[model samples]
Target: MFSLGNVRVRTKLIGGFIIVSLLIGLVGGLGVISLKNVGKKAEGIYSQNLRVVYILTDMQANLERVRGNMAELIYVKDQAQKDELKKSIANDKEENTNYMSEFESINISDEEKKVYEEFQKNITQYRSLRENVIKLVDEGNFEEAEKQYVPIRKVTEPMFISLDKLININVDSAKSANDNIKAINASSNMIMMALSIIGLILAILLGVILSRDINKPLQKIKMFGEKLANYDLNFDFEVTRKDEFGQTGGSLVIAQNNIKELVKTIIENSQSMSAASEELSATVEEISSKAINIDEAVNTIASNMQEASAETEEIGASIEEVDSSVIVLSQKAMEGSNNSNESKVRAKEVKDSSKKAIEESQIIFNEKKNRMLKAIEDEKVVENIKVMAGTIASIAEQTNLLALNAAIEAARAGEQGKGFAVVAEEVRTLAEQSAEAVKNIQETIEEVQKAFKNSIDTGNDILEFINTDVHKQFTEYEKTGNQYYSDADFVSTMSENIAAMSEEITATVGQVSEAMQNMAQNTQKSSEQAEEIRESVNETTQALEHVALTAQNQAELAQKLNEVIQKFNI
Candidate 1:
């Protein structure tokens, strides 16, 4: 026989149900058998024995009625009354005969049939005696009629006794049959209850056995799954049964072994990659260092070339400036002779304009100074407002904190503090709103301070510009105007001197231009060499960058491999 443990889970569940069903069927079969026996006994009592008892009672009643009618015939003296009695007696005899026939027709036991035959013989003798008694009465021989009634009367008691005995026998048989039916029914109920209890117990036991058999393997599988989830691959999966759990365990073992081997290979490869990356990193570092050195040397050379180029440009610019000044001086000297009278007239006009301008500038400067002072005062006020806003914000924060403390105290008081908590929450909300308003005010004040500072800085810059550039230019203009007025007579002498200096400046400008040309050619040669070195450095830097990138990629790959390998236990 195959054990339950060896069966598959589906088969085990099915077997459990089948055993429970068999038990139920046994209970049903017993009930059916007992009920069928009760039905047979009930049929015997109701159909045969009880029916015979009812027929016996009817026959006895009819016999008693016939005997009473025959006895009434002897007392009847009137012809009409005697005739009525005789008719009645005849009808009674016919009814008794019919009852006897009915009794004989019924199927009965041999003992009951024998009793019935004796009853029929008694009834027939009584009917014969009753007929003779009626005939004696009809002949007006009342004495003879009375004597005939004696034989009829003698047979009546025996007939009644026989009928009683038959009724008693049938009643006894009915009682025995009813008792058998009751016994059958009682046995059926007891057998059914016992069988039902046994079936229920068997079902429970089978269910427990099947559940244990099923859950034990499942629990082991679940434990194995948990271990696998936790990366613990060291335990043994010892379930080797032929069921699904066994197959699953076998598959898991194979997978675990495979993962172990795979991880080992991955670890080895990751270590190898790590080592190679380190070596490559070192090589890249060396290359990067050398590239940096080359770049520095190239940059130094480029810097020197750039310095030389700048010096050449400055020398050229100086030569151009000198040449332009000489040309201007020569042109001015020629114009001086023609404009000396014009200069004297313009000199007076310039003097008047300079005094007017100085007066206007003084007025403008005073206005600007007063505005700047006001701006400074406003800046101070804005700063004070910013401070006040900060203080208000701090106070709001403190108020919020106090509200929060109050709320906490209220919460600690439980139900009694619910109303207080609501009030505290409202206070906290108001504090938060006040804080927000203060924050907005602070932000506005800060913006105003920044604007004031910017305005102050602009005013200072204006003042500085006026004092440095405008004031100096105006002073020089005024001095020049005064000098021109004073030097009106000496203009021709100055003009002659300026003509002599222009010739000397022209000669110096030619020599400076020639030197500038030589310096430019040398600077061009140096710039070309610097460009070549720079190109070489750039190529080296790119090569080093490529090597570094490759090393970084190798490092990242090694790190990822290590992470993957760490997921399995060896």
Candidate 2:
């Protein structure tokens, strides 16, 4: 026999419904049977008992009619009146006989049958007396017929009493049958109510029992789902019933075991990853230090180049001053032999100033050359910073990968690894921040490289301008020196040539001054560009420092994540 507990849920539910249906069917069947019995009783009361009562009432009415006609016969004297009375009485008698015959055909009680028999005997005796009165009335013996009326009246009175008795008996039987039907209806109603209450109670109790049996397992399943949602995978699913709940519990146990294995694998892998992250952090730090050193070397080279550019501008200014002195010497030479000594003194001064300017110009040329070499070195440093930016970006990408791996492992560990997941997320975020910082550093380095290139281009333009304009101006000053020396020699012999020489010398001096002003402007622009390059380098260096700091923070977060993941026993 299959126990209810072991049955499938569908079978149990179907069985419960069948039982309730059968109970309701039984109640309905009983009601139908009771109603059928009541119907039969009602048919008996209406068709037999009540029908007999109605027939007895008709008999009584006919008896009264016969009695009335017979009493009228005593007063009736004419032959026609007598014959009318006789016909009326005979019709009344025939109708009463028909009614009595109908009453006798009906089923009646013993007491009613005895009363009906006595009624028949009285009717016979009344009929005999009526016949005699009719015969006396026919003979025109009215007095004798009136004398027979007394005996006839006595016999008819008893017959009427018997007929009334029969009516009363049938009426009583009808009333008794109606009372029985009322009792049966009331009893059936009570029985139906009792059966309905019993059926309802049974249905409710069965429903409750079935519901509890079904819902108990469903509730357990619901609780299990809640536990799973809460990430509590530690509980045992011990249901052993051979039903749906048991099957579900068995599935949950399998899931729990699988989760346990996965978590164990995650813990082992996370431990190994943590060690790798530490090594990566150290490697990044070493790279950062080397980048810092390269930045310092670049800054030193930029500083030296700026100083050399300043000296070249000073030399150009000195050459212009020497040219102005030569114009004064020429003018004094044209003034005459009396101003010859003054011309000689001014001419010697111009020669000395020209020599000094030439020497300074040579020094300026050397400095400018060295500055160009330094600018080339700065360009190399810019390249190095760009390489460092790429390295940092690579390290940041590796860190992001490591963080991703840790987060995946933490997720596999479920509730036990939530703390680690948070830490991994922080590390991942830090890695993203580091990557963004590296990108900023790369952009800043690019800006610095652009500034360096501009500065280098500006320096080259300045060197080219000096090579062209300064060399031309220096050659013109040498020619002016030769003219001044010749003018000194010919001050007595060619005082007329001295005036033209003076005007020419003055114009050459003005040209030298203008050339010097242009050189000064070029130098100033180069200096400003150098300054901008220096600021850009400084910003790039700062950005590198921030990248290093972010890398250090990322390393710390990875360590923390590793430590948290290690705490899980798995």
Candidate 3:
């Protein structure tokens, strides 16, 4: 069934207002119609009835004036006075005729028209009689004019009666018009009053309907909201209407049911979680014990690995020392080889120089002896010998300069120039010796002639000794240098072999040391891993304990929630 309760509030209010407004409109419209009708009837009465009455009254007044003028015509004897009255009587009759025309022009009913026609006939008779009376008066027949005028009373009497009747018709019609106006006014007042009452009733009914439709459900929803605020879900609110309030109340019902179910589920889950938390606490303890044992074992292995690493480091250090010693011996052998080779080179160079010196000495001796003998035969031997000594001294000076230049070049050669520098120093010494011998020979030139023969004999013995002893000493120096070079070469080769072996041993020791270090690092990492595992187990145990506490709290909260939920009546 369609119900007003299910109707929208706005629609209800609007329908109620429309009904009241329509009633008001009807009331207003009826009043306007009634007033309009009254105005039309009043206008009809004024135009048709009142105006006719006005014209009839004017006609009656004209009759009276005509009657008075007729009497005046009878009494007056002056011709001028009679003429004046006659003119006045004629004007009065003309005015009455015009009034009759106006009366005929107005709208009237058949009965009013009949009565007006009768009045018109009687007034016509009265006017005819009045004219006869006036004609007699004008003829100076006073007696007869008086007699004629007396009969006018008979005509005017009925004429005035018809006039009064006609007037009364209009009066009666006006009265009826007033009565109709009164009736319309009375009916319109009644209808307006009825409509007013109906509108008021409708207004009140609409107020009641709107207020009840909105406020009843609103108050219910408000109460429901208050209960929900207080966490009371036990209040049963059913949606009885399809209005806005009903829909909102339905939503609240759904929310309360959902919350109730959720609280129940949480209670059950809390119980399960509490049991699981206890089991997990025991498992965490067992894990912590095993983690501690593994940590101790890893620490023991790490300690043994550390000892092995230390021993490997010691062996590496010993091999390093041996390698250092081998390096030093190899360096010494290389130095001996270089020095021997230098000596052998110097010996070879000295031997070649000695042979050149012997040749050059013999050529110089023969040439100087021939010059000396020639200078003696010319008694210029002393001067020539002195010149030769000076020449020799100059050569020695130049040789010393060359030796100094050689020494400078040797000095620039660094360590390799030590042998060359020694050789240059010997050359400088020989140059100085040559210079001294030149000085002595120059001082003993006279004795040189005396020793010339002995000098020939000494030269023979010197050449033989130089050719034999000097050549032999040069050869022996070359041999000894070769031997020293061979020995030094042998020593250098042996020392290199020893150094290579030592380096190989050192590299082996280094590899062992590195392996040991890696093993120790692995052991240390294992120990740290064990420590981390133990710490993680301890942390996990702590976390489990926290979780257990939290679970217990959750269970308690769930129990409290169940108790709270019991307060609701959803």
All models, RMSD in angstroms: 36.6, 50.3, 34.5
Model 1 lDDT per residue over 516-541, tens place: 87888789778878888888888877
Q: How close is candidate 1 to the true structure, as a TM-score?
A: 0.48
**Tens digits of per-residue lDDT for model 3, 114-198:** 8767777877787777777777776778898888777778877877887898888789989988998998899889889988997
On TM-score, the stronger of 2 and 3 is: 3
Cα shift from native, residue 269, model 2 (Å): 9.0
Best by lDDT: 1
Number of backbone-clashing residue pairs for each candidate, in the order shown: 0, 0, 4
State how far residue 50 of model 1 sits from its true place (Å): 1.9
How much is the lDDT of residue 40 in candidate 1?
Answer: 85
Candidate 2 segments whose C-alpha is farther than 4 A from its true place: 1-4, 258-570
Weakest 10 consecutive residues, lDDT, candidate 3? 372-381
